[model samples]
Target chain A: MSSFEVPEVSNKQVIFKNYVVGKVNDSDLEIRTSQLRLELPEDGTNDVLVKNLYLSPDPYMRSRMKEDYTSYVPPFTPGKPIDGYGVSKVVLSKNPAFKEGDYVTSFTRWEEYSVIPGGNGLKVIDTSESVPLSYYVGCLGMPGFTAYVGLYEILKPKQGETIYVSAASGAVGQLVGQLAKLAGLYVVGSAGSQQKIDLLKEKLGYDVAFNYKQETDYNAALKKYCPKGIDMYFENVGGKMLEAVLDNMNKFGRIAVCGLISQYEKENSDGIHNLSRLISARITMRGFLQADHANLQPEFLQKMLGYLKEKKFVYIEDIDEGLESAVGAFVKLLSGGNVGKQILKVATD
Target chain B: MSSFEVPEVSNKQVIFKNYVVGKVNDSDLEIRTSQLRLELPEDGTNDVLVKNLYLSPDPYMRSRMKEDYTSYVPPFTPGKPIDGYGVSKVVLSKNPAFKEGDYVTSFTRWEEYSVIPGGNGLKVIDTSESVPLSYYVGCLGMPGFTAYVGLYEILKPKQGETIYVSAASGAVGQLVGQLAKLAGLYVVGSAGSQQKIDLLKEKLGYDVAFNYKQETDYNAALKKYCPKGIDMYFENVGGKMLEAVLDNMNKFGRIAVCGLISQYEKENSDGIHNLSRLISARITMRGFLQADHANLQPEFLQKMLGYLKEKKFVYIEDIDEGLESAVGAFVKLLSGGNVGKQILKVATD
Candidate 1:
């Protein structure tokens, strides 16, 4: 170890070359290791040097490139390192709460090293665990928070209500289904393939699961599975699916609009006509960002960990071993190619 | 009055012929005035016969006929008169709280007379001197309640927020826009015609107004009006309008799903595809029924009456003379022909 030059301390990052129209290809991103040092400058006031370990590749990235997406949090800069949720270790810190060797979870570029700023964006990850650290990038992290907030805060799951989640095998959807089930809800979910559908019912314990791709009529499928009608819909893949759900939702039904992977790829989308269902059924649909639910991390982690220990919750991860593979994995995840949380292992244990 | 052999009348009704579609024709209803020759019934028995004077023509009635609308409320039975919120004079009381001659509001049929049984659905209307008796069927009635519930209860209006209400000069929309303006919001509205648009800005006091039919592209119109992005969308028209609104919604914006008149007549409707915006924008979209907000009526009426008396609020009504004209006027109302509350003057004042 002493004989090594530390590779000149350069940084490796995944960058989006340009915005693609339809399905994103692997060639869209380039993994270039910079000649710049990975460590933060000694005089940098608020920045902290982070050694990235795990990175989450969510489906929402697909919608970021569209010219229509201007009003949202600015899209990933075309030539800059693509940023997302990740787990990292602080190698150096100028921020008061974070010190050298501290672990934190936040939005970080898909790179082996990064310099993050101080203030409200960063939080120290408490590790008194009987769990794997990578779980922080999946179940104990953003995806988990997505599920927790959707169920407790948005959906407001009541006992015995019929809950339906789309993309049931995805990281957030899987956790949401399980949480609804724990609350004594009759849960149903839809995934792209039969394999994913089976995973939802068999592994995730969803009361009913359907392959939405194979189901020619999404509304008919919803009617078949949700005989009494849906009390809540945890939306993931929007478009025809939402139209169908709107038609089938019961009175006072609550919908947590989480993700809509289906329409993100399309340049022009179709009009939504079933909105009258909102008036008739009196549904409450809300969209949320996980960052807003940071205050609930303690409660979410405590409950999720308890479920993990009792074997009540199961999480599956699709791993990409290198930064170069992150783009392909992310693209595939957007197209519903991955079974669960699409993860990139930037630095292995 | 002496020429007519007014037998000891018991009850009279206007029964519907059948479920009419498209535009309601005159043949749809028949007024059957009869005398049962029975004395006034007892109280606490749920039976109350009120001589109904005013009946509201709401757009939601169009949805009540569809076989698919069972998810909300049961369809109006064909033989029974179509019922909605009405201001009536209680001639005989069977419900304990409501006495004879009391002006009560209930889901009364479109008839000269109605017998309502107290199964938890009647409210005594204490007429406010500041407003007209007809207002109970308009501003101080269901429309006001709908606006109050949708804006304050569902939308949670914040100061200076931009709110866009469709059907701007219509019953619910007019009140909602005015209330939003009163709440310090920058309110815009979309109406059916230039006249309606004029009424929105000049009469209803909407900050900006557009005639949706004249705008070839809803999305473009939304962009033009809400350049900085809309903080809240009071959704009424669905189909293309909803799709367009989705594109212009700001992150964390709230959309109160009030109604969807655009798609009610279409056989095969367009599906909502832009719902994916919910994920990227972290928007909160919810729907509510006025029936659920019944509890707020007392307070709503109090405030609304004060506004009307003080001239802070002005409501317009498109009245059709006699029961004979009701069906046509209601049909016109459904076609977006009427500018405001479409009321049927069942009896002479």
Candidate 2:
């Protein structure tokens, strides 16, 4: 019945070499090639084959590199492709939900191709407009939803209130500032670089942005930038930054604990003092995972799509070309090497 | 026409000598006698003259001793009497809210008699329930209300969930343990000494109790006692104990930061590390004051009164006699010297 032989494909991949310790290095991951038949397995299993286009290089991934880390995501298997959120095109499908040529955002391996069982978590992308495919793995993906849920759902930003976003130029922080601004909040931000600070203040519509690395005292910087005091905090970088923010928060302030990117690679995470301020200020510090707020996805997509269509939202992605650049992009994302949302561009069209 | 000639009285008082810097001592306070005519001022300030009966000496008073401290209540004036909640009888009333010879709980200074302007914050005691007048300063006053609000409103414990309370034998903590127990929670507590530990487990109905002073590693102690992981925490003692509790909390756990007595007298508060767990565990840490939820007082009174009337609650007080002992009782309360609620019995009948 086969008119021609199915062509084999060379699947290039980024494989995690071992359980990482302390800070990660380029050597911890290796770019290699493996043979693939480009077909579903013979076993009676419902699965879909997808060719990955772009992969997100996120800071939260650092926690999963440890052998015995506590996180929602499990540790990466040694000698296996690193798994993460990515944009892909369904190459083949045995599941009724997905078909060939369907463009989707999915939990895919860090490889040219991945076989997703039951086509689970494959969200079909609405590529109706002129939006780039790479944005699906960055601004319109998990990172974007994280910003939405963390701000609107958790912190519940009110009009005329002030919100401080740390790591302001990063994936989640950038969008949080913009969303808070749209919601009529006085948005303030702190980033490591002058470039990101500029982006936050100018392009992202933050009321004020400061270079935290240049600022000798975070508390003083917060006071100078946010004169009225911070009413809400989107905490990304932790340790000393958290302590300072806690001191400056207004009465009944809320803190959305999204990520502690700065402390991820440290041998011992920084100690946060000044928690006595929590009682004095009646602060509510809540740590959250976007997966827990999956109920907000549909609304998040509609609102974010509207912002993009209206050109009201600025989605910045630092896309590294080729699959081989994934490790570098990931390392940059963790080390604040990238200027914006870090992503690895694996394919075009 | 005067019904009787007013008698001049010598008021024995404890006055704050100065703004205390380090740990408090007996020298920081002075017991002095001052003359009182027991008459309202001629300017008609609508004040009431109160005969002070029982005085509450609490850990929260330690913060007021500092010149630059931030609290809902302002710092103590150097030349004025130390103010606290106390049971008193209105000897003379110009304000219609209180009448002569009526027993009430009011914010009065640490003295035998106090002239309160406008009868502000005075709650008349029924004396019909047969509850002791001193109970108003201990179990039925701020500390009891503190435990009520912290457990029910902030922590919101669920049946069968585990609750860990620090400073478990102290004023607020003892009530929190008993109330949480009544709420069908698995209550684990930690105190400074073995006697307090016995009181917590044997009498207060805590499922388990440990001496934090004896436990070398607080985290280890929590793990051993709270085998199921802590879902709700009544955080009375902060610093290292808070650090340990944060690590032991379960996902989506809640911490009611009622008091941080351990850090109140310290020059520098302890640094809370492992806040990264706040994100991983998706915890909610809230610091609250019972005064903020003042509306709950009537209900707190009704429920607590029922608990007492039905002989369901045990209220213990380590009462030191007279105004002269106020300083020592207060210092003992701060140093964990008292077995239960620490209060000064200013006068009987």
Candidate 3:
């Protein structure tokens, strides 16, 4: 039917312009409209054409913007679509594993529609649950899994232990504090703004939430808030914040480093002083990636759904409308301008 | 018999004059002669007297020289006899656990004779073997145990992995390099002096050894020596050397921070930069104390003794004769002037 009269299926995409040095600017990414062929290739390639619903612009994406950044993911190619974790609905499928109308989460591009080559990175989502679709990119997706693995595996939180989460209002930190509290830990958090700090205490049920901006001295603030000292630290922000955590960490304390969002922008960062405290205090500091613990995904999804259904967990997401807001949403995320998990709502089912 | 004529039982001791600021100087300790009454208490105190043999002036002891250093052991009490790990001969005993003439390794004062109340920390050495008695303090005691725990427990060496030990010719590093080789690892090390470097390569059998003092850039040095990035690091000297190791650390690397000898004398240590690499590389850096792994001691002692007897392991010690050389030996040890395990030979049994 489409061959006779082609539908006006012009796909709007956020394109990577070039690799960035320090902080990413508006010029680093560009919004461009490109023609779409809504049909799969007949060359034995199992590509699935999907209509993008939501795109999660996480802090980790900034790493891909660097030319030399090597990690689990390869660097995004300049002049092409930027891909990340997103929610999508299958429009057409050549892959037997996925079919039309199948709702799923996959590594998709920042575009109105994406022909996910060979249906790679796609995982079918169970739409039978009443959970919001965007939660796939927020709580039930990568960030949530990161929070879970970091807390349970690395930190190994014990009941009554004090767990301090930095960037407590951000995507991963929000869930970490909530999960720590469920595990019978005394949860403390630090966020950039008063609004974010209030959200941490009032909504997230953190025992103590402080505005790091208002408090000039991080060490003094930690000392005041974490009076008994921090038993475990969920580190997101790096530099001064991490140093302060080291200062307040108790003997045999553990640190789960999920991100260093603060240092990503700086070419030259101030090195951590008092790492010697790591020796005197007998601390175990580990850097972790969620991909390493993919085996735990099935249990993670099930348990997180149970928490959501029982009204024990509330996940907050800041959604910017359409593919046009993709760059702005990511920029806001890196600059600490957004509240909760930042997402770009490309379309609605 | 003493009623007719008194014996010249003068206890010549090294007394701590005061706590040190910056590097410890000659004035910080004093050698004094005090008379001793060579009799055990009859009031059921369970005291044991020991004649000191070899005293280990380990790098960790420098921390105790500071007035405010808090750790597994308390700071050395100024003006009181400096207590340390030593090889000794039990002179008199009311305690049934240790009798007179028992050769043991224990926490003994730096003196000709020390009254160890209740014989606490007295671990009797099995002197049936032909190994040197001074070996008790050097390889078969605390230093050797530190090496064992750091290598097998902390680094968790895999066969064919590269392990780079800083302060390679020192007490702990010497044993660490040897143990790593036994574990089927490629071992590299760094020392301060050319003599120490030669000792590491020629005597200790390290695959590669470099004099860190001659290398201006530690990162470059590690790159040259450790062509394959280091998988495990036995961290002894902290600061710039540690920073360089971080740059050369392979993904999923483990750093066992045993000591920071370079930082012990500094009032303000240059903080560690490039810690963000920990996150990017997913590295695990841990600080450990040997005492915490005391359960592994029996196995360590037996295995090490076996290695020594088999001639598969060679332990070298630099002995400074008499209690008079105690302060000088300690200075040399901390300054990296002494090669191998630095020991003060008191009244050798």
Predicted structure with the largest lDDT when compared to the true one: 3
Order the candidates by DockQ, highest first. Answer: 2, 3, 1
lDDT for model 1 comes to 0.80
lDDT, candidate 3, equals: 0.90
Docking class of 3: medium
For every model in order, the TM-score on chain A comes to 0.93, 0.97, 0.98
Off by over 4 Å in 2: A1-6, B1-6
For model 1, residues B183-258, the per-residue Cα lDDT tens digits are: 9998989998988988888989898989888896988898888777899988887777877887888878898888
Model 3 stretches astray by more than 4 angstroms: A1-8, B1-8
Worst 10 residues of 2 chain A by lDDT: A1-10
lDDT of 2 by residue, B1-349 (tens): 2425767899998999999877898999999999888678656688999999889998888889999878689999998899999999999999888899999999999999999988899989989999988899878999999999999999888899999998888888889989988999999999888889889888998999998788969989999999999999888888888878888889999988888888888887777778888899999999898889999999999999999999887987898998888888898988999989988888885
Q: Ignoring the other chain, what TM-score does chain B have in each prediction?
A: 0.91, 0.97, 0.97
- Backbone clash pairs for candidate 3 read none
For all candidates in order, the CA lDDT equals 0.80, 0.89, 0.90
